[model samples]
Target: MLTVALPKGALLKDSIRLLQSVGLDFSAFLDSGNRQLQIQDPTQTAQGLLVRAQDVPVYVEYGQAQLGIVGFDVLQEKKPQVAQFADLGFGHCRMSVAVPSQSPYRSAMELPPNCRVASKFVHCAHDFFSKIDLPVEIIPLYGSVELGPITGMSEAIVDLVSTGRTLKENGLIELDCLYDSTARLIAHPLSYRLNQYNLEHWLNEISKNSQPLAAKAS
Candidate 1:
């Protein structure tokens, strides 16, 4: 049976909607109060596994799932070994550097050498700082990265910003955007080769549906 991993957070609803367009009804998983991670489709041709957004890639890479839907941020941060099949185009956001609005640091370069930078995405932050030649200390935080600047734990933060509202509420402002991200469809390479016909057909259908939605969103 074909298996797909779906992230459980922001992208979940849209992911289910997209899959339903391709004849996969995942509503039971969404509606059921069941805490079970794996849900079987009535047809039994495919199954859906609910997982952490960050772990979706891990499942696909390990062949635990034939396909997975997750955000580009996780792909960038994890750098997992998998073939990215389609940009699902939902869950849009950007990874950015932000600091307290009143801070003197106006740009990436303006940050003093070796200043502490906090983020859940340590590798992404490291690469970005390296490219800009701004040497810094990395202080990893699990959640609420906005607290980094507020508490003086770090001079700046690298985190996903969906809207400016969270930053504004925290008295922080975006310093520079690192990357624009959206959810994407990813597949294990071997699984794609083995299920080539069905997977390609599925992807093409989703892409066709996505164009209109993208236009509407724009």
Candidate 2:
């Protein structure tokens, strides 16, 4: 059976919806009491594996799952061996460089060399700074990076920002957007090549249905 790695957080609902559109049903994951990590479509055509958003690619790359739904940020951070097949276009956000609103640095480039920047995404942060030839100490922080600047543990932070609200509440401001992120459909490289479980047909269907929704003009 075709097995999919479904993300367990914010993107889960839409990922399930997209799969449903293509004729797979893993809706049991939505029930408040449904704690099962693995589920099967009623039709027995496929199965779903609920996993951490960051671990989606890991499962797919290891061949435990033929496909996965995950954020672009995770793909970049993990650098897993998988095929990035489609931009599913949900869970939109950005990777940014931010600092305290009152900080002297107004832009990423202006930050002093060896400045400390805390982030859960150390690799992404390092790559961003390297492009500008700015050497920084990227503190690997796995939780609440905004506190880095507020607590004086770091001069800045490299983190994902969905809205400026969190930063504002913490007296932080975004200095630069490194990249925009969205949910993407990824597959195991060998599985994709082998056309395992006839994955291509479902991929085409999902691709046709999940284009980024258009914003209605006022």
Candidate 3:
């Protein structure tokens, strides 16, 4: 059976909706009382694995899931060896550098070299700084990275910014945006190359039903 890995947070609704458009219903994951992490589609066409957005690529890369849906940011950070099929065009956001509102630094480049930068996305943060030739400590903060700057533990934070509400409420300002992120379809390279479980057809149907990769969701 073809197994799909589904992310568990904000992207869940749109992801399930997209899958439904392709005739695979995995909406059980949306139930208010649904405790099951693994569910088979009612039509028994495929199965869904509910997992953290960050782990979606892990499952697909290891072949635990033949196909998966995840955010582009996670893919950029993880760099998992999986075939990126298409951008599903939802879950729009950006990874940005933020600092306390009163901080002297006006941009990522303005921050002093060797300063501490905190983030849950350490890899993305590192890559961004490396390209700019800034030598800084990338502190890995899995929870509440804004606290790094708030508590004076770090000079800035690299994190996802949606509507900028959280940043505003915390008195943090965006210094620079590393990249915009959207949900994407992914498949195990070997499985995709071999068309295992007739995966190519399903992937094609999904792409056909989704908006063009360049079309952002409003």
Tens digit per residue, CA lDDT, model 2, 1-218: 89999999999998999888888999999999998999999999999999999989989999999999999999888888899988887888999999998988889999999999999999999999999999999999989999898889999999999977999999998999999898899999898888889988877777777864312110
TM-score, candidate number 1: 0.95
Indicate the residue-level lDDT of 13 in model 3.
94
Quote the lDDT for 149 in model 3: 87
What TM-score number comes out for model 3?
0.97
lDDT (C-alpha) at residue 136 in model 3: 95
**Residue 33 Cα positional deviation in candidate 3, in Å, after optimal superposition:** 1.3
- Across residues 13-35, which tens digit of lDDT does each residue of candidate 3 receive? 99999899889999989889999
Give me the candidate number with maximum lDDT.
Answer: 3
Residues forming the 10-long window of minimal summed lDDT in candidate 1: 209-218
Query: lDDT per prediction?
Result: 0.88, 0.91, 0.94
Total backbone clashes of candidate 3, pairs 3 or more residues apart or in separate chains: 0
Q: List the residue pairs that clash in candidate 2.
A: none
- RMSD in Å for candidate 3, one decimal? 1.3
**Candidate 1 CA-lDDT value:** 0.88
Tens digits of per-residue lDDT, candidate 1, 121-211, equal 9999999999999899999999999999898889999999997899999999888999999889898898788774377666677777766
Candidate order by lDDT, decreasing, is 3, 2, 1
